[model samples]
Target chain A: MSPPVAPLGWSRWLVPPAALSVHLSIGQAYAWSVFKPSLESALDLSGTQSALPFQLGIVMLGLSAAFGGTLVERNGPRWAMTVALICFSSGFLLSALGAATEQYWLIVFGYGFVGGIGLGIGYISPVSTLIKWFPDRPGMATGIAIMGFGGGALIASPWSAQMLESFGSDNTGIAQAFLVHGLTYAVFMSLGVLLVRVPRPAKTAADGGPAPLEGVQVSANSAIRTPQFWCLWVVLCMNVTAGIGILEKAAPMITDFFADTSTPVSASAAAGFVALLSAANMLGRIGWSSTSDLIGRKNIYRVYLGVGALMYALIAWVGDSSKPLFICCALVILSFYGGGFATIPAYLKDLFGTYQVGAIHGRLLTAWSTAGVLGPLIVNWIADRQEEAGKSGESLYGLSLIIMIGLLVIGFVANELVRPVHARHHIPAQKEAVDVHERQQPA
Target chain B: MSTSDSSPPDSSPSGRRGLITFAWLWVGAPLAYGLYELVRKATQLFTG
Candidate 1:
């Protein structure tokens, strides 16, 4: 079906909330940690096994978004949001059944395979619509939605903890919690489905999206063939890997860095540090991305990559000596990580135009899937080897930090390599007219 | 994808303003709640 176009006088301000409804709901996937302990104990599974559902969910999130992005663009945000609501909620309900029956694979299939599709679809669903509605401020528009993704965990972490507390941390409790999550998100995400609207292309594109150069549109197919896309793919992957290196190991890394120092990070303080990282991650999604509107996407990425690399170097140079310095570096690194995500859609709009930008963004998220595994693996592997070598304190992370710095340097070079797409990549004007005709018609 | 619920119709100036308020609040309230909880947890870093 063709997406619902905005009514003649619909406020552009309304679009961000619609996008937020879906993003905030899917952001709950980050809170899988909240269920990990209970799943490990109640399901009688290994730590690796307990991680299966979440790991698979991340993997499938990338796969589905990559494959399903075109469908989202063709079908519109309303269709994509509805699909997300169904898949995400049902994944939860199915996991509830799995927990109740003591069948682990069911939970993985439900949450990872099925619900993961929801995460992916839900993620890129609004990009095209928001960019269409707020071409003047695509960075800020997308920042609000992506920020909701990081912030989703803040809400779900506490809410899920409370639910597990009330329901007890046993198998029955896990099942009930999953069920409630499924039902609750279904209801909440329905708001996005109801509220989202595509711009009426002929009219509203001029109304909301009237940049003189915007008419030069690139197809999703054409976008991938450009060197610009691959450069960004590497840029996103390296930036995310750097952030995840610290994020996945936040609590432990904090405590370890300061273990032999004057001021040790106690377990409680380490927990607090993780909370601070989340704050930076959430705020940077909106803050730095919005700032990109002022500074330009390329310059903003210089901060994320060049300055981000400097932050890693500072950590390496300082070692375990300074507590406050360590926290400051890590927080800035994470803000850039989140900013990279939030600013990317606008970056794509700048390079590709709004035509199929959502699909292109979807394709770009494969970098995230790769980084999700690559980030944790690089950090954990290096840390493990360092520990085996009798390294103590920040020494365990010494090699990992250097490798992260190398990755950031590579990413910084990639950022510098990005230039505007060649005119050959833009969709031929004659063909674009035909595609626009097909787009306006219901399929 | 079709749903019974539609954007709150904007027939007049006040009606449109009400919608802008309602729309922002729909998402903003929960986000504020999340931020509040996050701030509460983060304070332990300084305090503890």
Candidate 2:
């Protein structure tokens, strides 16, 4: 149960790569959409049936992260990363077996359940550590690592698509792809397990060394009891709901919108659209979060939620009449979405301090899980109902777009309501003083 | 808690530079590959 350490004389900068290894590997969760069509056709499954594994995986990701936050905090990043590696890779291995045997439930249980645990644990493993390492730039440091999660899908989408193409797209091909993904990611994530290290205990500030407690510290247990936490919870959930609503249906929505135009979007063009969104997502994670370090977390989220709502309104108003406008709106909304994710850890740190920021972050991700369900359900259900009523093109999505705009407005209000945690929520100075005294007592 | 607590300095200058270089390569390689794929996809949008 000792904290992790780098080899003799290693620099703190090396830690980000360790975080990236785990995030890039588990971030494959974002690319699950790439497998949906292949799995549906191969297994004789309906769209809903095919979506089960992905939907459930997101649910498990939030749930596990919420519950496992403490264990990760207790155990250190090496243990958390190792556990993530085993579960995530094994989830893929089990999914391969499921695909080979044609048991769809196995895929759901394996990828959705086991693999998702890996996602949750792997995600939070780096946050508290990164904040501690770059106390000077918590936003930027976490941004660098979390941006990998956004980029993960960018790598996996084309890679998985190519793998399916070469391997033949049959049951066996899917299994082979799954197996390769599992093995490769396992090896890749191992670098994180090997390299990540917690800083050695801080020396006194008088010695010109790292000192703990740079700001007011709120323990994780106390953070949840405050109104600020729940307000942020709403803000995150609504922002994600708005962005994911579009993301889950990006390709089809574009085609449906532009189909009647002279320049109808081809399927390949639609895929390129998805990649463009990923690029924006990745770039915004780093770009906006770093900007938050300067502008402050609260001000940046005003842009994410408030301006994001405006983008949605513009899309709804302009409809599909201008393709460039449509794409531009979508890209900006998605950048805010990614920015929202990247910035929240620092937001929590700003309010709660680095003491249990990781655990607080884990609790906050329940918002993502909730949004994962709500976002797609709102978009797809409305679109499906609209289509049954004979609506086509932009009409199919217009209402859904409006609904998303409303959600973003609600998120904007929540963000506006967020205030600093009250003094009652902060850890009593006496308790902290006693702990420091006890630690310094000769062991 | 007050605002004056400073982050620990890196153990050494060369070691810090080496670690930064190592980190860039390790994380940067995969990211660059993803960017390449996205570029390829983007080109298809116009090329077609």
> Which runs of model 1 end up more than 4 angstroms from their true locations?
A203-215, B1-12
- Candidate number with greatest DockQ: 2
Chain A TM-score, cand. 2 = 0.92
What's the TM for chain B in candidate 1?
A: 0.67
For residues A171-221, write the lDDT of model 1, one tens digit per residue.
999999999999999988988999887765452233332222245689899
CA shift of A393, model 2, Å: 2.5
DockQ metric for all predictions: 0.26, 0.42
**Each prediction's TM-score against the native?**
0.94, 0.91
C-alpha lDDT of all candidate models, in order:
0.88, 0.85
Q: Model 1, residue A124: what's the lDDT? A: 92
Superposition error at A133 for model 1 (Å): 0.9
C-alpha RMSD by candidate, in order: 4.1, 3.1
